[model samples]
Target: MAAGAGQAPVVTNGIHTAGQPVELSIGLPHNLGTRIHLHLTILATSIIVFLSSATLDGAQAGAAMSSFIYAIPDRYNPSQPLTTSLYTQPSSQDFSARLAKVLVRRTGKLCYVGGSMNLANAVGGGTVDEEMEAFRAIVAVVAAEVTKARNAEE
Candidate 1:
């Protein structure tokens, strides 16, 4: 669904895998000033089947996945930015987390992960490896930048 002006757009989609309904929604807010806001929610009929063989049980896997979402703002930094705040809901049960990570940038250009559909692809199997890999790939470029910034300070 389209968000109102000065608001973030909301994208919702779902799929059925292994006889389970998996739903995902991502919200991207605009003009937040030195901070970007992204909200992600994943819901499934059976959390286990939806997430596909995750090593952790429902709660653990949910928390872990939540962390991945919270890391996005920092992982995808925008030029010399100072701080990033992230909020996420990886599953039902009122489970959520907020993360704020410090960042320093050396480049003028901004980088963000496109093709959020990739996340849906990973959700099909719900395997820990699959999910983490997708999460890692999303942040890999920014992770490198963060590392470089840290090294420069040392």
Candidate 2:
């Protein structure tokens, strides 16, 4: 079925403009530990692979994450299957700023958990009696960088 053609559920915290664009997505927090854990692990891996600096580049990552949410139609519900984005036009800088702030705010716990896991990996040796040690070392290093980056935000 078409997006706008369907009746949108009334959302109070953030209302969708009747004529505005929307994008349907499955927000990550709902994942079972397997998916979320693997996802954070992958994100940590990517950060290690691309990051050259010794600190957490929160502003850079936070800004990028925030910019991702601007959108198309109103058919999006956090509980459903991911949908294609409905783009009507570019969002304003103010909107983006608000979005970024919200993103950064929302990221508080995920960021903390990732950082914590990184630390655990770092101290657990390059090879664990139970798991891969190299990943932990990598995680520890990334955690330090992220900590440095996240601290900079304060």
Candidate 3:
């Protein structure tokens, strides 16, 4: 279901064996900069986020998939999750790695993060600063939603 007015939309899309919804699809409000779209799929056992940079008009994808990062929380040190690459490692590798790490630390769930992003220029994409801003915003939203869902379960 969706949150109240002025809140991000968190949609439940699947059910668990216990007859409770287990999957959530979250879409951050468009006002966030960078024209980026973050789709956080909260499965029963893990969290997968598909992120993409869109053109200014939001009609086309602005980047290509170059990296995939996964993280599982380190029980002894939540700040530093065990993160690793699962695919091509782009020069901007730290972006996804850090995102996944933070999400795992916050939600204590295995997180798989894959996305396409590029530096902003005449063609498309967003500036490094803009991208960073978008990522931070995305992490906050994902962590909050996942935590909220887990709390409900408890």
TM-score of each: 0.24, 0.21, 0.69
* lDDT for residue 33 in candidate 3, whole number 0-100: 31
Give the poorly placed runs of model 1, Cα more than 4 Å off. Answer: 1-88, 92-118, 122-124, 149-154
Per residue, candidate 2 scores C-alpha lDDT tens digits across 56-137 of 2222222112122222222344222122222212322333223223323323212211111211112232124312322332
Better of 1 and 3 by TM-score: 3
lDDT of 1 by residue, 2-50 (tens): 3456443333244323323333332223211111112222122101111
* Candidate 3: tens digits of C-alpha lDDT, residues 1-154: 4455654555545543322334443443543333445556676668888766544455554466758988898888768899889986665578888888888877888999887654453132445655555676677667776766676678
Q: What Cα-based lDDT does every candidate model obtain?
A: 0.27, 0.24, 0.65
**For candidate 1, what is the TM-score?**
0.24
Question: Highest TM-score: which candidate?
Answer: 3
Residue 49's lDDT within candidate 2 is 21
Top lDDT hit: 3
